[model samples]
Target chain A: MTLLSFFNYWVVIILMMVGFYCVIARGNMVKKIMGLNLFQTSVFILFVSAGKIVGGSTPILRDGVEVYSNPLPHVIVLTAIVVGVAITAVGLALAVRIQEAYGTIEDDHLRDDFDEEDD
Target chain B: MSPNELFDLLILALLIVCALAIARTKDLAAAVILFSVYSFALCLLWVHRGAPDVAMTEAAVGAGVTAVLFFYTLTRTGRREK
Candidate 1:
């Protein structure tokens, strides 16, 4: 494999880890969502990168063109972007409600509030 | 290795380091900021991979819109107690 290709793969992997770490370790709802976004973005990057072909043109069908980077990844990314935005919107709305219901957004604090109410 | 390869590696290392820091941070805002960094790094990676459209989406939605949403939520909610 070429050095450039090697670098791209490693970068995507590294970014993925970072996003996962944030989602898993952070205590706040918003931070968790941010991590989730990062994770999804990294995945999108991975898909797009995997679809690339050296010296390939846009996936438009053309005369005498035998090689083209897969357009499937591009279409997938577009769909994913829309989904990600929708998720973020819903998550934010949930966060707002959580704030109203518990007067706090922190996961630990929200849990504590729930326990107090249960008691 | 070529300069481009070296740069990519460096960016990858930075992305990992930022992610680790985000995970370790107790402050929610800081974690979100680190997450944005991770997203931005991934956007660059996508561009390098020749997916400019995907990279653009990542930059705009992942790093921009999502980060703003996170910050908005953080400001709306209180921090965890000690």
Candidate 2:
């Protein structure tokens, strides 16, 4: 297969990089959560794309369809999606608590507060 | 390329754009909305890849419930990044 044939994987890599950057470089707690979601979705796409078969139909059985895409990856991604949402909810709840405790959700300010507490 | 390949390329392009926009936007609420758009584009890609069941779950949970959670958090924590 040519390089172009693997375009989906290339997109996944780009997306993964973007999400990684957001998580590491951003300071806003909510933005970090968004970045984590972005990263997780890219992974989901990777698995689903890997499972696709050319000239295949959906996993449902039918009269004339001879091949169906692998259903295992789809099942895995479905569970991951649900778990990802739960993670997001928990992360946001933590952000709310952080805001309540610290009065700001910016990472630098939180660090400064910690420094003050130490001294 | 055939039409199917071309369509796949288009959706992937949209996904990348949505992701970049989410990373670049300063407004937390706008980023949340962009994330929903990204999730919907992903769901479309899942459908195109012949996994309607996963696509349905993504549409309902990824684009629907998650966005609401983000919005509720935004209301509590505030919207500006700084």
Candidate 3:
């Protein structure tokens, strides 16, 4: 396929990489969570866009509407978005707790704290 | 290309830009706001792609609830990346 045909997928790939980089490169706990959110969003976009069919309308039953874009992916993405929200909530809660306990949320700082305790 | 394809391209461009900006920014609050913009762009793309239901959910959960959650956490934590 030509570049235009696969452009959407290419963008998704870039976004995934960007998110992954943020997760690995950042020491801040909240930043990592944001990165994870970006990664999940890219996946959601991938599935939803893949479900589109050229010249087709929404997956609703309407008179004189011939083709409908695949509904399954939309349904799947909907569930994924909810799951993502749950994940974000839990992750943020954990981050807050980490801050409260350690007084800092940077990964390296937390590591140093653990090292001092082990001594 | 048709208008639909052009719209898709524009939205995808916004997604890439937002993702990169979020990654690059050192300010936690700015990153969160950029992410909200990102979510809105994705929501718009979903609507244009014939998935209005998914669009609404993304708008509400992604842009609304998620940003609020992030800001709440930021208030507890600090806004600086370092």
A107: Cα error in model 3, Å: 0.5
What RMSD, rounded to one decimal, does every model reach? 3.4, 1.0, 1.1
lDDT agreement with native, every candidate: 0.74, 0.91, 0.92
Candidate 1 residue lDDT tens string, A38-108: 68766776777778887666566669888778878888988988998999889888988987987776778
State the DockQ, from 0 to 1, for candidate 2: 0.88
List model 1 lDDT by residue over B24-66, tens digit each. Answer: 6777777777778877887776666566677788788878987
Chain B TM-score by candidate, in order shown = 0.87, 0.98, 0.97
Between candidates 1 and 2, the TM-score winner = 2
Q: Each candidate's fnat, in order?
A: 0.65, 0.89, 0.89
Cα displacement (angstroms), candidate 3, residue A69, comes to 0.4
Provide the TM-score, chain A, model 1: 0.87
Give model 3's docking category.
high
* Residue A16 Cα positional deviation in candidate 3, in Å, after optimal superposition: 0.5
List, residue by residue over A1-119, the lDDT tens digit for candidate 2.
35545787899899999999999999998999888988998898889888899879999987988899999999999899889988999999999999999999999999999999999
Model 3 per-residue lDDT tens digits across residues B1-82: 7777888899999999999999999999999999999999998999888999999998999999999999999999999988
Candidate number achieving the greatest lDDT relative to the actual structure: 3
Off by over 4 Å in 2: none
